[model samples]
Target: MARSKPATLKDVAALANVSRATAARALNSYGYVGDETAQKVQAAAGKLGYRGNRLAQALRSGQLPIVGCILGDIQNPFFARIAHDIEVLARECGYNLVIGSSEEELGQEVSLLASLRSLSIRGFIVAPTSADNNAHLQGLIAENVPLILIDRVAEGVDCDSVVVDNEGGAHKAVEYLIAMGHRRIGLLQDDMRIFTSRERMTGYRTALGAAGIAPDERMIAVSQSTVEHAVDATIRLFSQKTPPTALFTVDSLMTQGALLAFRSMGISIPHNVSLIGFDDFNLATFTDPQITVVSQPVSEIGRAAARLLFDRLSGKTDAPQKLRFETKLIVRGSVSRRG
Candidate 1:
C-alpha cells in the first residue's frame, strides 16, 4: 500500500485559492485578512488537516511556551514533590513543563540543559548536581535566560534560587543527638560536590565539635542518594568494631536505607542505635519507630521557584532573588538517650 503525504500550509493555500502569505495570515490570525478569506483558509485547513509546526513558530518568536526543569533525582520524593508543584504552577501560567533528571551527574545535567536550550525553552528550574562546576549554568545567566535554582545552588551562578538552610537543619538534628548523650555519631551523606551534602556535612561536624566530640572519619559514610547505595555504605560504616551509637542521614532515601541495613544487622532503632534524617518521607511515620527528620518546606520550594522564573519571564528586572527557607526538626521515636 502506498502511504499518503501529510498536508502542508502551501497545499491549504492552493486549495483555498489564496496566496501563501494571506493564508498564513488568516490561519495564524496575526495580520489583516478579509472575513471570507479567513473562513476559506479555515475550511481548507480543516479539509487538508494541516497543523502548523509549533516548534518552528516558537523559534521564530524567540521563545517557547514551555519551561524546563532539571532535577537531581526524580526518584527522591522531595524532588518529586517539587517537580509536581512546578508543573502545576507552569500550567496555570499557560506554559508546559518538561522535566529531566540528572541522577546526580554533572555531565548529565549539562547535556540536558543543552538539549532543552536547543529548543528555545523559555526558562529553567534546576537542582544542580555540582556546587562548583557549572559553566553550563553560567552560560544561561550570561544569556539572560530565566533560570531558577531549586534545592541546590551552583557556585558563581548569580540567578534566582530556592533552597533550605541545610546547615542549620543538620546542626539541629545532630545537636539533639548530642544532647541525648550520643557521642559516637554517624553521618551518612551524598557526594560532597553537591551543595546540600557539603552544607549538611559541615553542620554534622559543627555539632560534633560543639559537643567536644572529636570528628572521626571512621564514623562517616559517603554514598549516592539511593536506597541501595546507602544500604551498602551504612553496612560498611557499622561493620567496624566501634560503630556509631547514632546515625544522621542526609536525605530520606538514605534514612530508609539505614533502617534496612540496621534491620539486616539486627540493630534496633533507639535501642541499639538511634537515627535522624534530613527531609521527611511517606514511610518515615509508618515504621516501627517513626523516623525523626529535618523537614523542609518541600511543598513551597517548587512553587516559589516557579514563581520567580515566571516573574522573570513576565519582565521583572529585580536583582537575583536568593530565597532560603528554614528547616525544622520533627522529632519522632527514632532517637533515644544514649546514657
Candidate 2:
C-alpha cells in the first residue's frame, strides 16, 4: 500500500485560484484580503485538509510555541514537583513543555541546552548543576534568549532566578541542634560544586564556629544526590570511631538514605543520633519518629520561574528578577535533646 501525501499550501493556493502569497496571507490572516477571497481559501483548505507545518512557520517567525526545562534530577521529588508546576503553567499559556535532566552533570547540562537551542525553543527554565563553569548559560544571555534559573544559579549568569534561602535554612537547622546541646554535628550534602550545597555547607560551618566548635573534616561527607549513594556516605560517616551526635542532610533523598543506613546499622533516630534535613518529603511523618526538616516553597518556585519566562516571551524587558523565597524549620521528633 502507498502512503498518501499530505496536502500543502501550494495545493490549497491552486485550488483557491490564487497565488501562494495571497493564499498564505488569507490563511494566516496577516495581510489584507477580501472577505470572499478568505472564504474561498478556507473552503479550499478544508477540502484539501491542508494542515500547515508548525515547525516551518515557527522557523520563519524565529519563535516556537514550546518551553524547555532542564532540572538537576527528575527522580528527586523536589525537582519533580517543580517540573509539574512549570508544565501546568506552560499548558495554561498554550505552550508545550519539554523537560530534560542534568543529573548533576555540567557536561550533560551544556549538551542539553545546546540541543534545545537548536530547536529554537521560546524559553527555558534550568536548575544549573554547577555554581561556576557556565559559559553555555552565558551564551544564552548573549543571544537574548529567555532563560530563567530555577532552584540553582550559575556564576555570572545574570538572568532571572528562583531559589530558596539555603544558607539561612541550614543555619537554622544547625542552630536548633546546637540549642539541644549537640556540639558534634555531621553534614551529608551534595557535591560542593552545586550552589545549594556550598551555601548549606557555609551555614553549617558558620554555625559551628559561632558555637565555639572547631570544624572537623571528618564530620562532613560528600555524595551525589541519590538515595543509594547517600546510604553509602551515611554508613561511612557513622562507622567512624567517634561520630556526630546529630546529623544534617542537605536534601530529602539523602535524609531518607540516612534513615535506611541507621536502620541497617542498628542505630535509632533521636535516641542514638538526632537528625535534621533541608527539604521535606512525602514520607517525613510516616516513620516512627517524624523527621525534622527545613521546608522551602517548592510549590511556588516553578510557577514563579515559568511566569518570568512567559513575561519575557511576551516582550517584557525589565530588569532580571532574582526571587529568593524563605525556608521554615519544621521541628519534629527526629531530633532529641543531647548533652
Candidate 3:
C-alpha cells in the first residue's frame, strides 16, 4: 500500500486558522502563545496529521545530527546486538545513525571511516580491527573528531573508550573453575594481538598463579574470530595425552567452537570436560548442558558509548575518558568438579 504524505505546517495553519508562523512556533517550542490558543493549534495540527520535517531542519542547521557506527564482524552476535542497541538509542535522541561493518579487516575499517567522513558525520563509535592501526585512529583524533571506541581500544590511542573489565572477568571465571576443583583447565583465547585478548590471557595466568597451579603454556590455545580457528585450537587442547579437565573460552564464538568440538569428540560436558566462557551467547541456556559465562552489560556499554559521543558533540571535550564496566559470573551447568 502506498503511504500518505505527511501533513505540513501549512496544512496545520489552514486547519487552525492561524498564521504559518504561529503553527511553526507552537510545533517547534520556540515562542510563547496563550494557553488555550496553543492547545487549539496543537489539536488542529494533530487532526491534520502534521509532522515536523527533521531533514529540512538538519539541512538548515548544517548538522546531520547522526553518529557513524562502524563495527567489526556484524555476523558475530555480540557485534550485532551492540549495533541494534546503538540504533535504538540514536533514534530516541533525535539523531539518525549511519552503520557500517568492517568484517574484521583493517583495510575495510579504514575505508568505512573514510566513507563516513565524506558524508560529514560528526562523530563515530567503532569497534576497530584487532590488528594495530594506531595511525588511522590518531588521524581522526588529530582532526578533533569525536570518537568513542567500544569493546577494544588501541594502545596510545587518546580517545574515550567503553570496554568490559576483560582481565577481571577472565580472572573470576578461571577462579570459579578452580574453586570447582578443576586444576587442569584449558584456555581458548582470541588472537593475542588485541589488547583485550592479551589482558584476558594475563587474567587466566593470574588465576592459575593465585591457586598455586603452574601455568602450562601447552594448555592455552590461540583462537581467532572464526569458528574454524576456535575449533582447531580446542581440538589441539583436548587431544593432549592428559587433556584438561575443564575448558574456559575467552569469547562467545570460541565458547561455541569449544562446544562443537566436544560434540564432535563425544565428550560429555562436566562429566568429561567441564566448560565455561567469558562472553555470554544467546543460546547459552538452550544447550543440553547450559554454558556458564562471564556476562558483560552489552546494552549498557552501547548506551555509554553513545552518551560519550553525544557529550563530545555537545562540546564537553576536556580529557579522554576510559570507562570499564563490571562483569558478572553466571553459573550454569557447563562446569563442575572433576570426578
TM-score of each candidate structure, all chains considered together: 0.91, 0.95, 0.82
In model 2, residue pairs whose N, Cα or C atoms come closer than 3 Å (at least 3 residues apart or on different chains), thus clashing, are none
lDDT of 2 by residue, 36-136 (tens): 99999999999998999778889999888999999987889999999999999999998999999888889999999999999999899999999999999
Best by TM-score: 2
lDDT of 3 by residue, 131-183 (tens): 47667788889999899999999876899999999989999999999999999
In order, the Cα lDDT scores of the candidates are 0.94, 0.94, 0.86
Worst 10 residues of 1 by lDDT: 1-10
Off by over 4 Å in 1: 1-7, 43-50
In model 3, residue pairs whose N, Cα or C atoms come closer than 3 Å (at least 3 residues apart or on different chains), thus clashing, are none
Of candidates 3 and 1, the better by TM-score: 1
Question: What TM-score quantifies how close candidate 1 is to the native fold?
Answer: 0.91
**RMSD (CA, Å), each prediction:** 2.4, 1.7, 4.2
The clash numbers for all candidates, in the given order, read: 0, 0, 0
Instruction: Give me the overall lDDT of model 2.
Output: 0.94
- Regions more than 4 Å wrong, model 2: 1-3
